[model samples]
Target: MKDHVKKILDELLARFDCLRGCEKEIVTAYQLMEECYTHGGKVLICGNGGSQADADHIVGELMKGFLLKRPVSREYATQLGRDFEDGAYLAANLQGALPAISLGNHNALLTAFSNDVAPDMGFAQQVFGYGKKGDVLIGLTTSGNSGNVVNAAKIAKSLGVSVVSITGAGGGKIAALSDSAIQLPATETYLVQELTLPVYHALCAMIETHFFACS
Candidate 1:
């Protein structure tokens, strides 16, 4: 476990009593991602509208440096320079990354899949295509009932992928489907989303600290 993992959650609890009683769920989510990355599995995220942007934002933080500077090892740096013409430049600039993909970002495929098949099945299709055993799918929906996100959760479950959710006051359909659901104590959609940012930010920081600290 990362040293800062517990610290981050503790900080959240100090700042937000509304998050009381949900510490375990939040911790479970961090553990799930930690396990997935440790086992060489990636995270797949999906949502709709604002949630879609959240999913993308998560990928942005994870697929590159967030808190710590994940410098390339000397061996890998040498290998990069040996392998390609611009390898040294690439090596100098690139940071170690956690494998993560925003399922909602493939605009072309999303459109084609929605048009060619079931519209609500877009997320499900992405889950089926990208998910593998041990991978984690994080479905974000304020209402917890987004059809596409729910469908994706269902598929992820069938395929032995771990499902974690971030939703509002009530853990909706997605909560039932998830292995762990961190439900914020907010009824309004925007408030729920407002709280979600900190929760995920904590998790992302913990995961990054876990992987890059010793390296």
Candidate 2:
């Protein structure tokens, strides 16, 4: 990791002392995410209820500027201006992005699949559709055992997509299914969710610094 990226992670650990022992797994998750984005692969995230919101939150931070402005590269900006009349304007207005998708955000697909086929399999189906080799799937469940998220992880693995699970202590089944399992020290749902926020925020900051920081 770059010094700046590692700094963000260090700050996370300092702020949340409870995350002390999870250092290795947190770094491992960051590595997986960094590798996935570096290889031109997107991320697929899934969860349930509050965890679902967290998944969307992660996508929000990733797909646009989080801590940095992330302006387009000069080469792309120049090409944009040359290719179209408003290309320069468009380029100036757009932000650099890390591609990501929240599986639970597709209400249409989720509801239809849940009603027609299997409720727990909705996320799994989306994983099968969006996941490809080199992609990464992140599943968040307070208990580490949301059936749908677990199923999604399973499918992600079959498709050769790496899996990262963020959950409370013990990490349940999803943790076992993951390539990197970040089990927060807290076990209660709310406490676990609280810890989750900072961890992911730090992850986003680390990744953004790695790819978009001004050197």
Candidate 3:
């Protein structure tokens, strides 16, 4: 890890002592995501209820600038200017993005799949369609046993995609199935969710710093 990115992880651990025991797993998850992006792979995320909102939140941070400007390279900007009359404007406005998709955000597909197929298979189906080798799947379930998220993890693994799971203490079945799992110390749904926000925020910040930090 780069020094700046490692600083972000260090700050997170210092602030959340409850996460002390989880440092190793958290770093592992970050490495999995870092490698995925390095190899030109996108991320697929899934969860349910509040966790579903968290999934969208993560996508929001990743697909756009979280802690850096993320401007496109000068070469790419120049190409844009040469391509069209409004290319200058486009190039000036466009920000580099980290590719990400939230499986629970598609209402139409979720409803259709849940109605015609099994409810627990919605995320799994999306994973099947969007996942491939070298990609990463992030499953956020407080109990670590949400059926849809767990099923999605299963499909992700079968497709050779790495899985990172964030759950409450015990790690649950998803933890066992994932490539890396960060189980927060708290067990109550709300408590776990509370800690989850900081953890992912730290992960996102570290990743953004790694890729876009200004020299």
Clashes of each: 0, 0, 0
TM-score per candidate, in order?
0.96, 0.96, 0.97
Candidate 3 residue pairs in clash (backbone atoms < 3 Å): none
Q: Write the per-residue lDDT of candidate 3 for residues 154-187, one digit (tens) a residue.
A: 9999999999999999989899899999999999
Per-residue error for 32 in candidate 2, Å, reads 0.5
The lDDT for every candidate, in the order shown, is: 0.91, 0.92, 0.91
Q: What is the C-alpha RMSD of each candidate to the true structure, in Å?
A: 1.3, 1.2, 1.2
Task: Write out the backbone clash pairs for model 2.
Answer: none
Please name the candidate that would achieve the greatest lDDT relative to the true structure: 2
The alpha-carbon lDDT assigned to residue 58 of candidate 2 equals: 98
| Whole-model alpha-carbon lDDT for candidate 1 | 0.91
Write candidate 2's Cα lDDT for 83-134 as tens digits.
Answer: 9999989998999999999988789999999999999999999999989999
TM for candidate 1 is 0.96
The candidate with the higher TM-score, 1 or 3, is 3
- lDDT: the better of candidates 1 and 2: 2
